[model samples]
Each structure stands twice: as structure tokens, then as C-alpha cells.
Target: MDEIYECPQCNQKITVPSEIDRAAQLELAELVHMGRRIDAIAVIIAKYKLGLLDSKIMMAHITAQKDTCVRCGNKLLEDGVTNCASCSALNLNWQ
Candidate 1:
């Protein structure tokens, strides 16, 4: 069997390479280097709750770089975006 790494906090397999997941640590290397502190921490908490290695990866899978729609959970828009394609309708749910 492959050697596996499990998180002590939640007892889940650490699938994603720890190196790729800067969001989990929310690196405090510098003030400017900090990765979404709140969101990263949320990702840490949400990881166990959601059964994943990292919340950022989870969000990326679900929301794609956290680009989902605030109203309908859509992720078709460009980066640093807030609204989805159908912001007004807000009827079609993505989840």
C-alpha cells in the first residue's frame, strides 16, 4: 500500500500535495504574501466538515478559483468577478 498522510485534526487522507495547497496554511510569509486568511482558515475548517484535504481545492472544484456566482453559484465569469451570467434571474441553482 502507498504510504498515506492523514490529518490529525480530522483523520482524513491528505490527497493533494501539501506544496500545492498554500491556501491551507494561509502562509504568513509576509503581509502581502498572505493567502486569503479568512477563506484559507475557512478552507481548513471546511476541509473536515466537507471531507477534503483543503477547502481551497474544494472551492476550486465546486466554484473554480472561487469564481462562482454570488447569487446562483455560477462560475462562468472572469476572475475577480462577483456576479454570474444570470444575476438578475437568480433562479437557476448550480449546486
Candidate 2:
């Protein structure tokens, strides 16, 4: 029977044979050395799941944002406060 594992990157579950754990482990190790820490952890976690090994993978999801200040940036969210957290300037332009 094929084992299913959850991808820590995109959160999509996948299936692979238990025997491929070693190869997967090697690939994940390379990713870590490349500074792709999150991706590496995801691959290792998936491989462990397929190998029927006990493992715990913790990952935090971060949403990307532009460099502009919160108020200067687009009106992404509506808050009752009038000042911007990033620049601490009055949001007079807010409408």
C-alpha cells in the first residue's frame, strides 16, 4: 500500500513508497544546505510519514507583503485607528 504525506510547503498531500525515504532524505538535506530551510523540512516530514516513522513537523505560514508602509500601501484592511503601524503617520489619505 502506498503511504500518503502532507506537503509542508503547499499543504498538498502526496504519496510515495517507503523505500524512497533515503533518497528523499538526501534531497531534503541538499535543500537545507541551499538555505531553503522550510522546503527541506517539508520534504523530510513527508518522507518520514511515508516510512511510517514517528515524526513531528512544525511550520509557520507567513504571508508576503510589499515594502511600503501599511498606510502608504493599498487599503488591504480596514481598522478604526487612523495612524499607520509601519510609519506612525496620520492616515489622512484614507477614504
TM-score of each: 0.22, 0.28
Error of 2 at 57 (Å): 8.7
- What lDDT would each prediction earn against the true structure? 0.35, 0.37
Global CA lDDT of candidate 2, please? 0.37
Residue by residue across 4-46, what tens digits does model 2's lDDT show? 5543334544444455444553454355445576664565466
Position 16, candidate 2: lDDT: 41
TM-score of model number 1: 0.22
Per TM-score, the best of the predicted structures is: 2
Let me know the TM-score candidate 2 reaches against the reference structure: 0.28
In lDDT terms, which candidate is top?
Answer: 2
lDDT of 2 at 15: 43
